[model samples]
Target: MDDPVSAQRASSVRRSLASIVLGFELIVVFLATLVIFGLSDLPAWVTLGGGALLCLIMVGTLGLLRYNWAYGVGWAVQVVMVATGFLNPAMFFVGALFAGMWTYCMITGSRIDRQNK
Candidate 1:
């Protein structure tokens, strides 16, 4: 029989670590959105609306991390983040940095979960 306690602990650790990383990304992306607002000539509504949408995606992705598809969604989020560079070129660097962090979180978190199990 499988050990429920062990399984639960692993899930807890994975979710906790995943949330931490995604939470940091959420903040960074929000800030980037604000920066885009100020720097880009993109219409005000688009700036605010797009930023709001990105934040929503981040929140959804964070909450849905327990599901396997959430990671796929996260990668899509990363693409959108990087694509923002079309408006603010600096975000290319910022987005890539966060993308790397996200990659690390996924890889390291998975390894930790495996080790714990």
Candidate 2:
């Protein structure tokens, strides 16, 4: 992959986006986990933050072996949160859904890589 229009630029952008997004998600997960545990006062907000962070990590996990651990953590936490949230049903689940779909899409994409190789 060179560039979208050129080949090089497109490949660079794709790789950069993966690294940047995964890095940010890891940071967010750590920060949110700390905030939720340390604060302990804002249960609603803290849980929501944790859920959000997990969602981000899940996004980072899709199909990259290096990110597989992140995907496991993110998806695990997200599933627990999402299952529990059914009682309240107030927040939008778009993030969680996207994360799941992204994982599926990434897994599907791996076939292309395998065939190419």
Candidate 3:
């Protein structure tokens, strides 16, 4: 049997780690958008609009982190971030780097949560 307080604490810790990753990713995605706008010949609206949309999604996801399904959405966001490589090849590396970070946080957080439980 598990203690409710410990379980809740573990959950809080995991959520905090996940939130940190997403928050940092939000900044990187925003900067990547600027880079894409400057380096690519795509129309201003396309770049700006797409960037704005992604940013909005990130912000929204941040609020949804308490839900398990939100983590799946986070993974989808990671895929989209990597897809941005089509607009700027550099984003492939950057996106992968962030994905690695996200993976690390998820794995580490889970381990910590389990240990706490």
Most accurate candidate by TM-score? 3
Write one digit per residue (lDDT tens) for candidate 3, span 1-117.
999865695467668888999999999988988888998999999998999999999999899887888888888899998899988888899889888888888888888878876
| Model 2 lDDT per residue over 4-85, tens place | 4435323433334444545554554555455555545557765667557565645545345343354455445445544533
lDDT for each residue of candidate 1 in 81-111, tens digit (9 for 90 to 100) = 8898889889899889888887888888778
Against the hidden reference, what TM-scores do the models get? 0.86, 0.38, 0.88
Clashing pairs in 3: none
Candidate 1 deviant stretches above 4 angstroms: 1-12
Q: What is the lDDT of residue 37 in candidate 1?
A: 89
The total number of steric clashes, by the backbone 3 Å criterion, in model 3 comes to: 0
Q: How many residue pairs clash in each candidate?
A: 0, 5, 0
C-alpha local distance difference test of each model: 0.83, 0.48, 0.87
Q: How many backbone clashes does candidate 2 have?
A: 5
Q: Could you tell me which 10 consecutive residues in candidate 1 have the lowest summed lDDT?
A: 5-14
How much is 105 displaced in model 3, in angstroms? 0.8
